[model samples]
Target: MGTRRPNALQWVWYTFGGKLPAHLSEWVLHDVTCRTWVLRHFLRALTQLAPFCVVVLLLPGPLHIRLSSIVLGLLVGLFYSASAMVETNEHRLIKHGYPPGIGRETRAIYRDLRRTARDEARRRRGWE
Candidate 1:
């Protein structure tokens, strides 16, 4: 993790596809590849979906209809967002000057680390 990070405004800007300053590249890398990357990606998707959700709410319709539309829209939006989570993170990394596929590689390395740690713990407990 990097000591330097973007402020709230800069974070929102970055979440919406704006690039942060070069100095924050390390933070950006961590943001997209850390253990909480999935939650981070979903938060970004929600931030991007919020406006459209409000618009759906405002559109003239029956109460249930408008609310249902918002729900369905969000479900669809999140579906697509989840589908592209890896690519999206990779793109963010690229924008921060990381080579392509770093996100995937980083996540894989973390997964292996977790698996190794789990196996070690299991062995010590005589459960493996």
Candidate 2:
């Protein structure tokens, strides 16, 4: 029997929050880390900001106000994209061959290693 392919709606749902099927999980994770994923999110943020920019440009207002509105809209869109979409991004990272808490553990290890090296250097210099 042929394997069934996911449909468009399924893809959207999975991208948002739906459970990824076992067979496609690896492929999805790889796709999420690829350059295409970054481009897709960048375009998504731009698309979200585009309408606001157009509206602000069309509004009857002083140039400074319109420019400020455009800037505000861009900031809001970026904040929304980063905050609201973090869950899905984290989920993808976790699935992409990274263990849960790997980021935290790695950071802690690096911090400790750097501290130890710094202390050793200071001791050698008679500063500790």
Candidate 3:
């Protein structure tokens, strides 16, 4: 049988960040594959946040004046958190052929991991 691929968390770290929490990584591996876990979580977060955003936007002037900064800050934090999580997951998905984007550093990481995976596969197949 073919050797198992590196887990999603490994791919995530190799592609973007340094490392992930062991529990979190295991969850990412077990529940998420091919980036579906992250995309699903992202959509879920958006669905939850959208109503709060709409309410904040549609609030009356008095309420807006009283709560605008607070609401905005909270929403901003939520968006940041949501985007980071999505990005972490996206990095994991790079193994499936997603482009790394236009940055030099990111492109280098993507290239390294892709090369490593390719080399390993070739080695296993006795094509090296």
TM-score winner between candidates 1 and 3: 1
Residue lDDT tens for model 1, 46-125: 99999998988888879899998889999999999999988888999999899999888988999899999999998999
lDDT of 3: 0.53
The best-first sequence of candidates by lDDT reads 1, 2, 3
Task: For candidate 3, list the clashing residue pairs, or say none.
Answer: none
Best by lDDT: 1
Off by over 4 Å in 2: 1-31, 88-128
Cα-based lDDT for every prediction:
0.92, 0.64, 0.53
Single out the weakest 10-residue window by summed lDDT for candidate 2: 26-35
TM-score, every prediction: 0.91, 0.43, 0.31
28, model 1: CA deviation in Å? 1.4
| Ranking of predictions according to TM-score | 1, 2, 3
- Rate residue 103 of model 1 by lDDT: 86
lDDT of 2: 0.64
**Candidate number achieving the greatest TM-score relative to the actual structure:** 1
